[model samples]
Target: MTVRSAWLLPGGTDSPGQTREDTRLAPVGTMLPDGELGTRPGVIPGGDPFAATGAGAMSLQVATGRAQVQGTAAQGAYPVCLDAPEVVTFADGDAQFDRIDTVCLHVYDALFDTAGQNLAAVEVIVGSATDTPTAPTLDPACLPLWDVRVPAGASAGVGGIDWTSALTDRRRYTAAVGGIVPRGALSDVGAYDGQYADVEGLLYRWSTADDEWQLYRAPELPVETITDGADTATGWTLNSFDARRHGRVVQILGYWVRSGETLTTNPNIADTLIATLPTGWRPVVLVEAIASNGYGFGAVAIGTDGKLTVRSWAGGEKANALEKDTNVRVAATFVQ
Candidate 1:
């Protein structure tokens, strides 16, 4: 018998043997002459075909072998599967999926927020039973324009950062330089009784243990230069009164010289409260003066309508009227 007749061809017993005119011989357990064995031409490798497509493209399923296609064409992007819990990993580098319309994948162990929103775009798993692909880690420098992160404090009650409140009904405290918290009402009697808060630039703080919120010195005291406004040519010495702010109070500390020199028409009013205190601010306490001349003592008081009166005396109880060189030093506190 000839070599073609000795072979068992793929057609059934009702079909004839391989004829001499037929150049392509396909058998049950042999490779095709061009090394492919699927429904379409130049498609699969190994033995049997898996499933047929309407476009005549057949899937190659392996019982114990792999069917790899290595080409740049669109038909070369076929997935290889193994038997029973075996994972088929693609080769490294960009294995392009050409002209794919829709892709549906199943992700495991994803995270979500309280409002049922996905927390991450893609999650990286470290290790799996079948595959050990390198997982990715987080990097802060690569954040998007509007990325959300969960802070690790009392403010994390809601779903992460408040992006919606910042977009819609924004508040001034939410954008403060030193950072801010939500506006909280002053407690009646608590540990935070004297604490302060800023609501849209309106300052408010607790007064006492049992008090509600009150405006905590809103309009700051204007910085005033307390000079005698005297000319150097007149040979008249100038007095100094320096004021500085410390929280809700102001501390005025300076020295006043009772320039005892003889007067030429009052010489621009010496040591008689030569400054205008702001409307709602006045001295609340005046410490004792460190006497220098005259029978001195120091006195500072605030009128009921917010007026600042500063005085100094020496050698006993006396009025604040100054005589030449009868200097007196004073320290006082004021509040708004």
Candidate 2:
């Protein structure tokens, strides 16, 4: 075992913990029911279509841990509902979010009636969530609705920071963001109802009677989201939140890295990486920091003698070579 294996052995599991992984998720809306995943409204108790319907209506359900909703073609300007608690309950119910996550807006290409016309811009409003006016004609920079092209035949769904999910539970409400709709419908299109566009957006309503969760897709408000930051090494366009970093125990904070056979690296590289990043932003490095945490994978420095001999790695800890001058440690020079 070399110096790397010594500390890599495990400091015991990192205490049974739950990572909120950042409780915010960007809210997104779109007109088409195809790609944008959300729980659509009015699905029967058995996942059947309801006889009744409403404007900009669609289907909604919880799948593989996401509250997914689907949209349709005849959609009018309506807000989509999301049942955060139910979807969230599937994961860690204790996860709490104080502010709205980044909103994920989508105006499905189908929602646009622009035959051959070009789009100028889109608008968004943090309706109902705040005392602010409903569907306030927000500016472009302020709204995340710029360049959002609603293809000739797709539905529209907008997303961004709305601030409606943070209601106090029977104890606190999930921090909910407002609407993610279109900009003036862009033409003689529908007017922004400032109401819930899809039934899915109103999935989880607070029950004052039982003091728990209930279901309702009222046209109105909501938002929370999490993502894996670990590295897969399989070469996916690494996002800043990978759950693991390849195999090294060094990616706990999220940064890009590579290694060489006879080269050197700092054991405290994590601290250094964190020091270099901006204030609230973390590097895109993730690792199986503690055992029982992930794939339980590892690496070792082997010796030619076939014995796992532990050598001193002064590579970055001390000097260039621990066996030579005490001041000249670190760099391994070569490996057996």
Candidate 3:
């Protein structure tokens, strides 16, 4: 029986026999979806796999890790692993120039390697030396682990590489085939833009332009209530005052009673201050909403300065009048 057929059926009296190549193909088949044979390649996220660290002046160490690679032309999927930390060193820096070197995990198969050894190894691609250098090109069978920046005149002893600021992590992770990527597996790689992630039961999309994860739905801020007397208007006791935000919308609800000084019907009350909203609850433009006094209906305006002002009154009530010991209800919704 053929190698593919050998693994396709259950063993039955010499009818089929599985080979090593068939066993290797099992993971690849399981990881790729139908009609998408060899498209995705990435590290399996867990235990800080393949994390890079500074070993010395010009050397960096890679921790034990596991990853998968899809060969070109969708030929096969190969699983790679590093059982122990491996240190990779670099040449001394150029006299007057800096360069970026890429550390990668390269997978070699008998089909592609002249030596015919199917294995994975750590390798570095040296970059060009210049004032402004970039990472080197990577082979299809390789996964970049990190980018190390070697400044000019850097050496092993006195003037050496600064471990803290020299390493730029470039590792990208992938999830199982036909699954939504979790928050822990999210990558900053721009190539994965438009990918979706499940973060704490909320869906987020990767935005390449912004280089960040954006919420798929509008964010709802927590409702904040104002109960302190310091935030209440003078002579006005708050019954209920609160503010909440959802996306670009700001809403405020307040019910207050005038307990002390009351305005007379002589002066204008078009801009009389009722209460002040907190900073984040303020609106860009004036927001006018219908308010209810104990006697009749009136209008209140929320301004950019966060002040809630009485605008007008109706139903035989004078516009310039505010009754004493009466309750006022104001609610306004506006875009920030």
Candidate 4:
């Protein structure tokens, strides 16, 4: 067999002085080795150099600047030659990935600080370019300025305005502004209730029934009946009576009916029967009970010891003239 190596020269054309033989050139594969032909083993363009035919040694050195590249390889492992972008300097911590469509980076307990102080104390950043961070401003009025937390297995309570803690066992904090301005229902004074701090023109308390704190004011007194030592004989009864205190005066109004025996005088009757009277106030000639008929009349007088005496009197300046079958209305007022 004869072998020939043919080289084609450029700018050759069949026209003018160019020959036809110059335009004709043999393929480079015609000179390839027999084992490298076709798609069989050891073929030049068939098998991959890094795979079935065994990979060749490759060493890369990046001195300065950057090299841009792009490509893809197997899924699980890193490729021998990574496709990169135009500017990539590993020493300067700069990297670019051309083939990756998206990249995600996650950080745990990431700290950003200036002069060793937390970033939260410094300027609040709103947006981020690489990590996509975000921050939202909060409204202080929408939340409590301070919250008191009762730790587990511990108890905590806030004292009212001017409320003093026990000297030995309690911790106290005095607020210049009295207690909290309660909202909702109000509570009345009780045996265990503490004194409220003086507000210039406001009052507040806790309503045990309503289960909420509320603004409060002085309440009206309720009508209470004289339950004990009341006359309950046949046809003799004391009807409903109302008693109330307003500012410095206490008032009582009621009616009683008697049909059996004539009434007698007793100095301690008012003190014993009317337990609703406020302290330090004795019935002073204050009680006057007159019957519906013009025949019966009664009177009450207070002694120096704040005790009262009840006596029946007549129209002729006679005393103890109270007769049977008489209905008398009694009304009196006292300074408290």
| C-alpha lDDT score of every prediction, in listed order | 0.29, 0.22, 0.66, 0.27
Which pairs of residues have clashing backbones in candidate 4?
A: 68-85, 69-84, 312-320
Error of 4 at 100 (Å): 97
Model 2 segments more than 4 A misplaced: 1-39, 42-67, 70-107, 110-336
On residues 1-336, what C-alpha lDDT tens digit does candidate 3 reach at each position? 000111111121222222223122224334422133464566777779888888888888888776776667645556665665777777778799998988886665556656345545577778888988999887667777788898988899755788899899877666666555554343444234666766667877767788887878765665544443326667687888766677668667788887866655444444567788877768999889778876676788888888777767653254545776778888788998
Error of 2 at 58 (Å): 32
Query: In model 3, which runs have C-alpha deviations exceeding 4 angstroms?
Result: 1-29, 32-35, 182-195, 198-202, 205-215, 218-336
Best-to-worst order by lDDT is 3, 1, 4, 2
Task: Estimate the TM-score of every prediction.
Answer: 0.23, 0.14, 0.50, 0.24
Question: Which candidate number would show the highest lDDT if scored against the true structure?
Answer: 3
Better of 1 and 3 by lDDT: 3
| Tens-digit lDDT string for candidate 2 (289-315) | 211102111222222221111222323
lDDT of 4 by residue, 173-267 (tens): 11212223221113323111222422335665544465444556778765444423322334446665555556556565555655546554342
Question: Residue 65 deviation, candidate 4, in Å?
Answer: 90
Count: clashes, candidate 1: 15
Model 1, 1-336: lDDT tens digits are 000111111221222331222212222122112113221112233343222111111111112222221222222211222221111111112122111010011111112112122111111111111222222232211111111111222122233223332111111111111222234333322123444554456666654554566766655655654323222112223366566665547555555564434222232223344234444345454333233334545354444344334443333333333445654555656554
